[model samples]
Target: MSNLKGLAHLRMSLDDIKSATNDFADNRILGRGGFGVVYAGQLPTTHRSACEPGTPVAVKRLNVNSHQGDKEFLKEILMLDSCKHKNLVYLIGFVSEDTERILVYKKEDNGSLDKHLGSTDLTWEQRLRICLGAARGLEYLHSSVGTEHRVLHCDLKSSNVLLDANFEAKISDFGLSKIGPKNMPHTFLATVPCGTLGYVDPEYAISGVLTKESDVYSFGVVLFEVLCGRLATVVKSKDEYEFLSRLVKKYYAEGKLDDIIFPGLVEQMKPGSRELFSNIAFRCLNQDRKLRPTMRTVVKELESALEHQLINLDDDEEIIGLSGSIGVYNGHELVTSLCFTTNKRKYGPFNPEADNRFSGSWDAGLFDGFYGRHGSYIDAVGCCLKAAARPKAQS
Candidate 1:
């Protein structure tokens, strides 16, 4: 508990937690998993240590009957406290009473990415943003943003990814995370490999050796799921399920890559960018763990594809290149999603969890803009603004 000293402000007494959750009422439950039940809680602003009244929170109470014990619960708290990133979920506080343990977090109004598989309207651009955000989060964990040591998310799966009030992705559930040697490039063996079935790296399964690459492997699977709108593992029949990766590889080898892409996404696909993404994903799926690119590499590759998207815009729309086409978006929509400007007009945090928030048609004008001639979005926007002001300068 000494490690928790710095985060004492986040500690909550059992009574306080109980009050916030209304005695753990069943209707307040948000979701349940093998380890616990997550309930939506409201922290009253009146309490000295509480968030504002009506501040939505997620309260995860350990299942008394479950095998997960106190150690795992505390591990998650410590891990969350140590990491901070826009793509990572924010922890609010925790409670530990006699024979009971609980953790708290800001309620990500949007649910997990896995829930949107059947969405008929999810766009490729939106999916790419979610995947890129998750990659950056994983990269932060592996590189230790400001520290010398690294952290292994041990569990990286679509289910562990929670969407914020906006559709921005946040990596969650660090109960199984492990810290690695400082500034080292070696694999650490785990007594048991930890992660979801389809997303687990094969090498970790065989050797019990865990490394940052294991997280990359899981992320690769997630990348495919985003592109395909299919679960990592799909039900083949009543009795069995198949790995989406295997099916995708089979189709890719046969040169029928279109067979694996999610329905609506095919029309949005650009040849060069699509191939680049597919190639990167394939590299990530390599059985030889050493063969997989680092998350940094993954980020750059994805960003490059996005940039290429800007370069390949429709002929008539060439002047206004998309910023995040791997370019940062030039329009208000992209600017809004990429920045801290929340939808103040909307009541409560925008809930994208129950429904796919990216489903609505993007404003054509919203995405219309010129980046001029720069490699990055910031530079392009600057260049275009200057061109627009050239006449004034002449006057």
Candidate 2:
């Protein structure tokens, strides 16, 4: 354990952590899980660098009675310190003194992705981007992150994905992670199958053989959660709980997935995008682990899905005008409605509303297309400009 303290991560004192978190006050708690309670707090002064002296941070204090003990805590610290990627959560420091076990991470302002599962404010584009980011993070883990071993995120779920202020996804929670030789493709580790109820891979559970496919299976459940706007598991009755994976596979096979897709999200998805996203997600749930797509393949498919979502007008068409309404939703000002006018015809007044009406038009010049900033909603929008083609001279 002494060698762990010698690692590059800042070693924070328990006193400093207690002071920042007000001794883990109830009000400072961000969330709780099987391991322990997470508290919102400030970075200890001892570890201050380019950032402010007391920059905000998240502190996860391990519960004394948690099933996850010192071994898991130490593993998390080692795994996180070894793997570093933009999409993976950044470990600021840790406190492992006496009986206390705490982890400090850079604060993700938007919190976990699970909190916004059923939120109408989260647009389809945002969901796709979040999924893509998470896939990339997992790909890095499964491949190599400047390490000889490939890390397997044994527990993958929506709640484990943190969102930054820009809504970028960051994979977190590494206590359950395991590593294997990077060169092995068919690698398998015999261990107790342990993960969240709905997200656990069925094959892994039965065989007690864990592999990279197990993570992919969990990721598939998360993808469906984003599409369905709900958790992977829901209580149907006191004794019976419905799993999203089963429901997704059923709806997908019957070609009735639209019936279960989150409201408003379907309207935002192009047929190509929706089909591609759903297809890959369904494939990940394949009972045969050999048939599941690798994280690398998953990332490529998600990229294609995003590309399909963007508007691609015909060669002859150009934007002629725009109309939309801006309004506040849940305290955030966003473009609540929008529509496009082309030289050929009007497209639509999508998400149409009457609040704070606005419009713009041009009789000349080329309206290349549209561009804007978006997250939970379209925060702002602007038109692309290109010089109009002059009429061909008489031949």
> Model 1, stretches more than 4 Å misplaced?
1-6, 49-51, 237-239, 318-395
- Indicate which candidate wins on lDDT: 2
The residue-by-residue lDDT of candidate 1 on 1-395, one tens digit each, is 55556767778887877787899999999889988899888876554554576788898899877756766777888788778888999888887767777888888888888887558766776676678788888888888555677888877888889988667889998888887865666556565877777888889988898888888888889988888888899778998989987887898789998877888787887676688788888889888888899998897788656644443433233232121222224552222111111122111111112221222222223222222222122233322222333455453
lDDT against the true structure, each candidate: 0.72, 0.85
- In TM-score terms, candidate 1 sits at 0.79
TM-score of each: 0.79, 0.80
After TM-score superposition, the amount by which residue 119's alpha carbon in candidate 2 deviates from its true location, in angstroms, is: 0.5
What is the C-alpha lDDT profile of model 2 across 1-395, one tens digit per residue? 57575664467888888888998899999988878899999866766544566888999999989988888888888888878888999888888788888999988999999999999999998899899899989999998574557888999999999999978899999998988777767668999989999999999999999999999999999999999999999999999999999999899889899999999999999898899899999999999999999998998788668756765566678777888788887997778777788887775454436569889995746666564444334655666655455455698
lDDT of 1 at 134: 87
lDDT of 2 at 303: 68
